[model samples]
Target: MNCYTLIKQKILAVITQLQSNGGLPADLKVDAITVEPPKSRDHGEMSTNVAMVLAKAVGQPPRVLAELFLTHIQEFDEVRTADIAGAGFINMRLHPSFWYAHLSTILKEKEAYGSSDIGQGHAMNVEYVSVNPTGPMHAGHGRVAIVGDAMAALMEKGGYDVTREYYINDGGAQAETLARSAYLRYLEALGQDIGEIPSGLYPGDYLKAVGESIAKNYGDAFKDQTEEEYLPFFETYAIDAMMDLIRDDLDLIGIQHDVFTSETAIVNEGAVEDVMDMLEEKGLIYTGVLDVPKGIEVDDWAAEPQLLFRSTQFGDDVDRVLKRTNGEWTYFAKDIAYHFDKFERGFDYQINVWGADHAGYIKRMLAAVKALSDDTVTLDIKTCQMVNLMQGGEPLKMSKRSGTFVTLRDVVEAVGKDVIRFVMLMRRNDAMLDFDFDKVKEQSKDNPVFYVQYAHARVYSVLRQAEAQIGQIDEVQLQNADFTCLNSDDEIGLIQVLASWPRCIEGAVIHREPHRIGGYLYELAGAFHALWNQGKEDTTLRFIVDDTKVTLARLALLKAVATIIASGLNLFGVEPLKEMR
Candidate 1:
């Protein structure tokens, strides 16, 4: 169903025939051959660099090779003409029937039309929104959640067995801080006049309910207990409460993880020691002093030797310390063990969606995965940059109710889940995004989400109008319509875009860039809107024409547009609206 792929295969077949006839060298490499849309529509429908790529190897000039390839390619019935363009590029124009038949495929296949099988069912673990279990998720975490979930969906569409995961950061100082924060709330619930929530403790009002729940469950039982005894109990309770809060926040935005891995559980299961021992056996672990990182001014820097991992051998900039001088395992030690556990779970690929602040950690994490899987498994880390929330072009400060940052729930409540998810993915994950309250909710072309959804709504409206004006046109009638009547330039251009859906999905999955889907959806929407506008200018271009045959064909095309839009929106976890209101 991918026209570009189909054309490439045809070109390769011609090259193979030429090789057998000694028209080209047998050993010429063809892997670099690519067939894509011509840079300018004036050139041709599609263009390829196959001639230039194979010319040197086949002992011929690029122009000579281009002419030879063009002669053979033009012989195919699907191709109307093939011409040599700049630098010996082969540009091709396919017959109109080819595009019309592809449009028919789209109507029949509907939402499943653009699916791909490139992943071959490989297990891929996409870990995202691994924010600490200390508080509710923030705006940045919302971006990560949307990116990861969309990526998982994209990979799933591309035939990968995807597991959406969240790694809870509950084994560090952050969790302890959360526990202390909850304890203060617990004291407040008991009517204690604890003033101004000590500087380091969480001061969000959301924890007040957790405190009340704790009091109701255990009734002054731990009021007299020492910090050592009560801290553990409170830490466990607070973490559970915070996780519940986080899940609720994510639920508002249609995000739910298949797996929620706990760092403490990994440590408790001796995973850290197991991985350290394995690395030690490979001579990657050692006791050594490390130089301070450049530009870091540590007031209490230590010079003593410590347990370290030889990560430099695996392409990391420096050997990392597994355990500090105080003998506690470092965060990196637990992270390494976590990835080893992921490998042992039988995933062939692992993807981590991290905040932009964690860019420096990518190399070390990749090194850990490489060492653990012996470079057999692939790990791709996508770092999501900051999201600046704005109201009328002015940046908004942290929520006073949330204490530190604007909660994900705050944004989702302001703009519904659909807007939040769609707008978050409108940019590349590594690029900074501005989420404007006034802009995203606007019902104009300026808002990508609204524009795309309006396209779907417009399609539905056309179908309704067509049914009321002309008699009802069901699936069978639409399928049997004479698509050859769709000879307008706008119609043909739209078919070309729709025919590229499978190729777009494949490229997006291979690049691990879900933003590409958003971009493609916007482009498809624009083409659809353009065609709709064309119908307004020319009476002959109207979808619901006097001719029943032409009307059915145009209806089929509009349905195909809606089908693809719904398909792409589903991957983004956003609903395609049937009506704009």
Candidate 2:
């Protein structure tokens, strides 16, 4: 069991004992009590501050209550000791055998070792990388895609039903720009010899392929058609082509969305007007003038009255526009409809992953979803910070208009999807990521992904070598082996790190952050490397000792490390390498 599980039992036992002794009030709530690891590892393997939090309610000194609870926790065999530390914190150091036993559990459960039921099978919808379907995905888009995918994977392991979604910006000014770019390319393909791309039109050569494909399919059929007639066809063709390119880019980076929701489809299905009507009926919609946004006021801000939603009443900074005076629905209107549709589809929670550039929009979007759903919906918007690409200690610049950007495909093709996925997930999503192309591809300990994967691969190498030299190893043989032979400090230390795997999963799932998994994997790898180095320094520390029984037991411990690394890698859809090549 994980430390959390064991400590939870201890906390519950102590709370029950206190209740029986009339130390706690009758009908006291115990739901808020939690037992987790302390911030400092030296303090304890597990920690609980429940006594401190409950002291005021129970009218008792925290240290006195902690001492009372310690007696009950100390009875458990797993808890070597329970003592009150500074500020009345209960620090519980688990028995050494308690930690060592997790190695056996890891081997027993294999890849399913750390799975938990925290989610209770709740449904969660995560939408990310909803970039406009007018061009290839850039590095920023890649970050969101990878983050969202990894989050979903982690949630699945934590027992949640998750739908990975992409909201296609297919009906907007951007789509029109893409259509115009394709038209220009089409003209050039027809021997018109268009000069430099104008400032408003896309300049990337990505559309050249789209233009050629259209020419091959339609030939001269579009030559005589009016702008109105051919524009729709070109827009559809170009958007489809762009989506195909985007899908390929995602495939290269190991991201596949379960749902692709199109904003254009919302309008096509008349859901936008339906949602507006629903909100109007709720008295949440009204026609009013908007105060000009501070620091970036539009010249037309005070020119006329615009249709507005009372977002400010629901915690937004200002009332947002539903439609412009030009009789077109605002982007916010379509987004409101999209989210309402998602709510209607029965997702309990929806998470939107956006680039840091959209930080200002979070309040309004959250406000819109709140107001539209009458506060029955939970909309979480995660803003991912920027990524600065570097190669050989220098900046790597990417510009779509300048045709100098590196596509996701380029990075994936260069480093392979597994390395790309692992490296991308090695940092917090909100923190700015420094992607060093050279370091990521390096086959050395400097690359965190390589280091973790090598640990797993090295374990496998040792296991395969044992099997070749001593025949197949099994659980009974390992359990019956001199597990006490694993008495070395390095071996015991490795087992302790493996014992934290289930705790790491719980933390990652609780915070909805997958970077914690990467951190745990790195530590586990460090433990494995330490054990391997110890083997180099002392022959008896190696996986294959002279006695076959002891060797098999050590092999079992190595298998536990491989099992955890594989599970962690699977949680991120990262392929654990067989060897560091």
Tell me the spans in candidate 1 whose CA falls farther than 4 Å from its real position: 297-300
State every prediction's TM-score relative to the real structure.
Answer: 0.98, 0.95
Name the best candidate (by lDDT).
Answer: 1
Show pairs that collide, candidate 1.
Answer: none
Model 2 TM-score on a 0 to 1 scale: 0.95
Q: What 10-residue stretch in candidate 2 is worst by lDDT?
A: 397-406
Measured by TM-score, the strongest candidate is: 1
True-structure lDDT of candidate 1: 0.91
Off by over 4 Å in 2: 27-32, 39-41, 297-300, 399-404, 479-482
287, model 2: CA deviation in Å?
0.9
RMSD of each: 1.3, 2.1
